[model samples]
Target: MFNRRQLLGAGAALVSTAAWSKTANAGLPEAAIMETAATQPPLHPQSGPDYNPVVTLNGWTLPFRMNNGVKEFHLVAEPVEREVAEGMTAYLWGYNGQSPGPTIEAVEGDRIRIFVTNKLPEHTSVHWHGLILPSGMDGVSGLSHPGIPTGKTFVYEFDLVKSGTFMYHPHADEMVQMAMGMMGMFIVHPKDPNFRRVDRDFLIMLNAFDIDPGMYVPKVMTMLDFSLWGWNSRVFPGIDPLPIGKGERARIRVGNLTMTNHPIHMHGYDFAVTCTDGGWVKPEAQWPEVSIDIPVGAMRAFEFDAIYEGDWAIHCHKSHHTMNAMGHDVPTFVGADKRNLTKKIRNLQPEYMPMGTAGMADMGVMEMELPDNTIPMMTGWGPHGPLEMGGMFSVVKVREGLTPGDYSDPGWYQNPPGTQAYEWTGELPEPRKAADAQTQITPRPGSHNTAG
Candidate 1:
């Protein structure tokens, strides 16, 4: 155990070095030395390297080196600039120079050694949130193990006993750390290469932040009123689409670290909830679903065959979750009289404009002023018009003749002629009224009817 004074002193010394290794001291066996080979076994053997890479959008995959039979990964915990949207960047604490950290990929039954170095001003600890590990390695600060002091390195060596989708975040000062976007995905592949194989496997972390408009740091205290929602810490337009070949087995592992649950909805295909962090769901227990609601601190893996050849919608079903920086307290003025109010306000303030008077859908097309480094409430221009999409929204592009290894964006789908909705030019139909109907309203004997 380290006292506050000792921890502070030790932390200061460790931060000076780039990244302190456990082998700094002379106590390493020949077999345990790090491997320097450029090529190694793929994390997901079933799907080759190209197809198995998890599309993190603005994030990245954590790289590692093999040592004997064990894999070692170094994670640096520090404040990083994360672009939540194209123009919106937030100062968040994460691992290896990115927020929502980097995805840790491993194979089941592999001995793994992870070294986490804290670079933040305050102390922190990395809790392997859903991994089954020894009590000390569980990483609950003050409970299972002492929190890592600032600038200090801590080693966690354990065998990945199971294969599933898991997550990691700070257990010490969890609220503040997680709210500042400290989290990551940990994926363990099955030892058997053929087990649960998929052609395209991708992962994403559903996260939320409460950065006020024009600000760069998220409010760590706000819970329910998060203005920025995202998949993989990135908003739409900035979020990349998932590209896959037509007629391939697609698997998407989604993990949520947000304050609320997300009902992830997909269009043009029905997928099955085939697995969870706990384990794989048996075929007898698995059921087909178009939307899967991942609760807070949980993960769900959905699988389906991409038989369609087009760009399909994939996003959270909650209307607000697909928008950015919307005012929650703004009154509903859909049918309210705002003519007099708008005139008076515009007279006093030339730029004043009564908003939401007609409806919010118009806000998507309205050229309203927005704060700097912030996205519009509703945005994203599509092939047809404004997509009116923002956070937690992206497209899954499935096309013919796509190379299995090529995950590049194929651009918007070009609808075939006569397949898309078009304007009516040759038809003119008169509105039908009840007066044209044969049946007419008649007064009852005792009713006080005015149509005599």
Candidate 2:
């Protein structure tokens, strides 16, 4: 009999396609595809929005607001277009048009008010992962309160009781919504003024996707499906490249919301783990580590002072996820090639010749047979077996002495040694003399105040 892990993995794999077919046949409406003709009237862009909202933390004011808000002031969830596979496009709900929404930055002891507005046809709520708060405000639809209804709004007010990086996502139909891209980062900074300042900071949330174009997808819960893809939302090399400069101290906030565990690896340096979902570890609890395992629905915060300068890759250490389909006997391409082969043969080709059937053979694509001599059976859950591969990966580059200003400043241009300079002028009016400027003053008591 197969073990439970194997079975769970297989079930998880099939959930996506199964859910898609079920939803389609049930006549559920299709989610609007990114960049496609609008299926419904577009919402009037958020009006008179506050692009910037102020949050007071530990008596310090920090800038915090949801992105993609009309004019940048409110939290707005909208549909976005993304390439799920070659020649395939899928629509995902995003904050400010990004799958993993904007990063909310705050210091410890800050009161945070997140105003979440639902734009989808369904009800949704925001869960503050790992943050200690009253259960009523936890954002679980049934457990916390009725979820925010479509076109309505809800406010999540909480305090940063601890300092660390956490995440936010929909608790209603989470497996489906999260896979569809309703998630973002939340960071609580330490109140200590003497904390080490890093040269740069970045947020990375690892998730997975089981999507086929033009269909509704569901969350894969069993381990069977979990094996096919590691991280649903591919971060490194899929969306944007992670950048680091040599000798720069980089702080990375990582969160894992996938179904399975991800043993994340960062090349070239062993960093210090400073915090977790619960908050900063005591001095005795701190330790040095290079790679860490992040569990589902948890967050981990670590700091790495770069020592080497190169493009170092970070990814899940699961053997199959690192290798494409584990050499499964699946076809690599579909459409024209598959059609031509089928036409030439006057019938369907070999079991593995059809598109989307690669990696399903009893013998591993590597030709390795099962130890028991039984033909390895393939299921319709995930891409292949529990050991399926290729998700949740990224890279970090560290270079020597390159400051943030070095890359962003217009006048101070620096190219790798021996590279030519590329210059461009910015379009902005030059500053005028103070004496030539017009001034308006509101009269009130003590109006005679002047700068020393």
Candidate 3:
């Protein structure tokens, strides 16, 4: 195998040889490369309105340019290295950089022009989920339009007539493409900025993966038995917390593309579903909820006041969705007699030990070896103890002095004196046993005599 320096030299030599051969074959003094007509001119300056960009954890918004009064944004679909969780990385195909690509924020009434460059080995198309547009630009890949060929560019132009939380993904070979993590959120801010103002806005995409142990790519065929559940392609410990100002109105927009529904639960606030992909929900029709279930292929936007200041948990209510790399085939060992089996196994392996014969909670915090590129079923260190939680979990940090535009992590919260939950240290009182049933129930003598 060649070392780094040797590989660099070899790559340079190959490039130089290729260039010389191309020039010689052309019979020209120098190789001439012509630009294609599809390569449009650089965008020009515009005096159009812009939306208040929301901070998406492990994601970002695409910047747009005004090209002759049209909002132009570019998306490149290609392979990317995504950190699925701490110490676990997956090879995925996404737009620009990360899986669950950058958010696209726009204002209503803007003439939007999006250029999609396909860099995948296979053909793909971008479907603007829940967006109103011309049928030709629907990006259905052979149904509404032809698929964007590999190494080719396709431009989608349309007028944004409605404003709501939307999503985008590939319609061509969706199963394989989406399984490899190709998706993003699209937010069209209302033209009237103050119509529904929010101090802080956040967005997260719910997705799952079935990348087995020691595997780099996800098994696209595995649908119902996904192991790696996450928000924005990131597990609990890998996800960033949502920072907001206390007493400020906040909005969280979530889009689900996974096979399962996620009942998103929040610790400290009761939020109302304010908007859907279709449109806004009227105030009278809205109800307060601590958890909201988001179905697959749907988007929901919830809003609430950050009245309590602390590190509040926000996660999927499904217990399994909160775990990492758990094996479904592992046998239930609880209450099983393994003393003789352990001795026989250790005689051959010298280090085999029987575990989970009682319960599985200890495995959450146990220090055990795991397969390469695989995360623990539960892992995270908390102030109190091992959090023993992973996947689809994060915190909402509400601080007293945070600014509306501030996106920096405020760090862990500090509770007031004697406020945090702690174990009771006082002496326990003796338990009062219930009186015997025979002593408590006294039958009448006359009734017993009559019965006899």
Candidate 4:
């Protein structure tokens, strides 16, 4: 997860360079850059209309300055080294300093000026996805305006006519650029603070990468078989846990930039989809859901009251999405008898172990040797035992009694007496063989019909 919006919101410089003098906008603001990947505190409104800030999980907000009546921000699109997990890293193209670039937040009707400096090797342009603006500022290269040539800065001035969840990415060479992790979340708060407000607001951009083991850059050619699925360019347990106050209301806005859909499921509470990229869903139109299926290139905002206090899981329901670096072509050995093969393989290498006879859960607890800069297929140690999980996974740590704006992890939730599930040692009935059955009516366990 990314951190240090404070560095920009409060300080605004991780070695920011001088604005390009060749550009038209002479008074462009300094392009704030993030240097770390820790989840920093939310940037409260230093100026402009006051609305509750959103916490970008493993990410940060792009800082802006008030120039005249318009809010100004600088976005430098360049190469960045993003840590996908503890041992893995990827060199990707993104805005500012990280892949799935720093979030952009503004009000409903504020006039905004964004200076985009292309530090990339090739021509680039930033497309404001899902924003209402004039044709010239739409950022569609060759259609609205030409790409900002390398080492040049271009200004995009537009008015935020409406408020909703949105996204941003490159329009020029979109396939290669987006596949290399060039995307970000754009959240526009309502002009009126009380219009669908929540105590804790959070954002997550679902992204994926297809980097091979020991590689530094993602392989852009790979399509649906991404090896790593991430939230804001970070995998779990690298993804920061959402710390929620016991009785406070919370909102989670998720934007999917991947090639496929992801059904985000949250344990312990049923929420309602309050908003989308199109607009806010009316209160009467909201429907209760424990899991919301977000389609490709779309966004969904769900809200709920943090009633039950627990270390509830919030992750994609697709099983493969939870395993890191586990490729699609790995041969299945669930029912194959590898005992004989293991003997032959062990003769050549004494440490070779045949797995997946019963299941692959052993991979989570076993500390086997792996390649450098490679995340395990299944990892993470929980309070009980190994989590046996990996990508697109995070915990919502809800606890009682703490600071009102505390976003720190509350550790694992403690279950009350006799509340946790325990092992059962009781015996069950035995199965009768087909030979022992008299006249069988239907086929049952260990029992079959006489006629095929």
Candidate 5:
């Protein structure tokens, strides 16, 4: 198994260095860089909570909890908010009013019945992504049947055909409804008698969002502005802190329902990709890959043998998303000084800043300059400006060694830094430029830089 984060870090370093040297030697004007920056809009702002719906299986009602603090999944076909960038208070759709929906855990052969109530003011339906069900039960609104109208209820009955990680979300108006926060994770366990040896299992749902109701009204989506992102809803670091033991072999099932592909990066361990949407791969197909590119509408399962002990940052590989507030503008840099007048100043108080922009508002919502040897440990991924959007993200802490203990309170595990406090230390790392000297350079056939 290859640790996904380490491999990607190395690849990014190499590519960045190559790009830098090529541009530097070409003597491109500085204006080119500025022009590129100006053409690029800031990252989107993400908000809302995970979806935690109550399910009735075999006449038993079980409440599925969101891994973090996600509250609901708002499913609407029409535009509820009048604008895109403003007035978009963190109102979202959820499983029982939570984002990331609920985590459904079931054993093989169990028949599960889920009742989905549509509270939004429009029509919608739930598509169980990656599940091998009959097409009529696929829940694609028009394709499956007329969608569940507002104030009506629909029954979703299905058997656990296979055992693995799966997901659910509205298939109609997918781009907008999903963007508005309507999705969740569903899991099925193995039925084999020999498959009961696992210690701990977890589910991670990746998502993204856009806008800051506190700073500005949410903006309407033009073709160019829909790029705001999140993971499970909030950008990483801002969503919730994930804690794990130092030396535990954890089985993590990851699902991606966002619009783009995510190279989910986990630190300190190389794990085996044991299963995919089509189910477990053959023994030969199971190999080591650090960063697996999970395209939209796909899922994967892997077991990582945690070897190192430290607080590690896990997120997407897209550099812009990893650094700031879903790529939105940092309030401090936008107009902090001018907006600091009495009444507005109260709004500018440190506590008033939105999720990702606390404390470091004065540094400007752009790239941060840091020492060469310093490696930033980030909690969330997004831009430093408004429309704070990115997709499902989180962190993983691998302890040095494991001890026998209960599932919830495994001893020797330390909570991540900044769990109790929120602070904006500085600007996020800039996308590596194409002209930096630290980049790796390959020698030409007759160049003098070649070394034996």
Candidate 6:
């Protein structure tokens, strides 16, 4: 409740003139800001209906206060410095104190009041994506209401008609706003606490940034060829692992705000798609899947029982989408002869080295210096060795005895004796060649081999 605008007292500009705007200015609620990129503990409801809270991957949920019969919340749209990883950070437009703003969670059929303050230089508006509400509170800049001008506050009041995964983003100058990372998840838990319940619920937001290797800001005009793909604005190693206790039923909700689709793949479990932005799929309609492809601007929720225990890899299946910075323009050097090129280049720069002739796997382990504030294209290390992974990647740490509420890392997994893959040194055999002659048996005049 302590904001410079609120300090103005009676002089503070009231929200734009609408029927609902005439309601008593409750004085702007405090806009809570998170400073760290680490995932915070779930915000357990102190007084409302009982439902397991959602763990936002690398984010947090906004808190609300009970005002009369309605739940009141505040959101501030401003510029922020967000850590993309430990070493890299981005200057982005966001809500509260982070890019991809804090999630707003409430129960179905609950009447809520939201106060959105615009701190950016330009005017903005918030669209309650995929939520059923009055047309006037849709947050569209022109059609439904006027933009919230800079340094001004606006109010949106509506009832949560249904419960499902939803989103919030700017409707004014959408291209520029969204590209700057002005978005967040909106969750409406079912009023019935046991409805489609799970032991652990999680939220992930998929996004991408097109910053050059050392820059701090994204190129807003980039339509494709993004350099850094992210989950909740954080890349691999930076992304928090999903920890599940053995036999625990877990649900993960993913929202895609990026320009392209992401086929998210999990290593060990085949889960059922249980919900989407439209609503929860009936139990009979749910289907099993190992890789769920989330389309642009859509949401997906999947659940599985954590019967197996270990460190399971979870990431996007698109090869390039899982890579980090400075690769799209890098030419293919695999199977190429770089010896002559290396010799010639050494004449000018004596320390120049040849790489990637065999494969880019070397990039993962090579300590070749990178420019300030960037990550390798293919990076990460695991229990075995160099993981050769980057963007949109994280592990799902499933173990037998993890404490129900603890989200701490349990280190690496220790495979039992005889369970790990070992070197096969007992046999020597001739490498087989394909039946080349038989393969060409149907060849016509255009292609031929002498053998018959």
- Candidate 6 least-lDDT 10 residues: 10-19
TM-scores, all models, native as reference: 0.84, 0.59, 0.83, 0.91, 0.58, 0.91
Tens digits of per-residue lDDT, candidate 5, 12-120, equal 3322232212224222111000100000111111222111211211011123211123211112222222111111224565544345553555556656555566767
lDDT of 4 by residue, 138-254 (tens): 999999999999998888999999999999999999899999999998888999999998999999999988988888798888879889989999998899999998899999999
Local distance difference test values of all predictions, in order = 0.77, 0.52, 0.78, 0.86, 0.49, 0.86
- Poorly placed runs, candidate 4 (over 4 Å): 1-26, 426-452
State the weakest 10-residue window (summed lDDT) of model 3.
31-40
> Model 1, poorest ten-residue lDDT window?
30-39
Across 139-190, the per-residue lDDT of candidate 1 in tens digits comes to 9999988999996778888999988889999999999999998999998878
lDDT of 2 at 218: 27
Candidate 1: segments with Cα more than 4 A from true spot: 1-53, 425-452
lDDT tens readout by residue for model 6, 221-333: 99988999999999987898898899899999999999999999999889999999899999999999999999999999999999998999999999997888855667777
| Model 4 clashes, total count | 6
Model 2 TM-score on a 0 to 1 scale: 0.59
Q: How many pairs collide in each candidate, listed in order?
A: 0, 37, 0, 6, 96, 1
Q: What's the true lDDT of residue 75 in model 6?
A: 91
Candidate 1 Cα RMSD (Å): 9.2
Better of 3 and 5 by lDDT: 3
List ranges where model 3 is wrong by over 4 Å: 1-47, 337-340, 350-353, 425-452
For candidate 3, give the lDDT. 0.78
Q: Candidate 3 residues 1-452, lDDT tens each?
A: 22324423432333223211222332111111111101111111124564455667766555554445666666788887888876788999998767878677788998987878788999999999999999998889999889999987777889999899899999999999999999999988889878677877888999999988888899899968888998989897888888889989999999999998999999988899998888899889887899999999998889999899898999999998888985688887765667778887888988675777767778666887778998888888766677778899988999999965766778888899898877889999997766776563334453331110
Global lDDT for candidate 6? Answer: 0.86
- Residue 66 of model 5 has an lDDT of 18
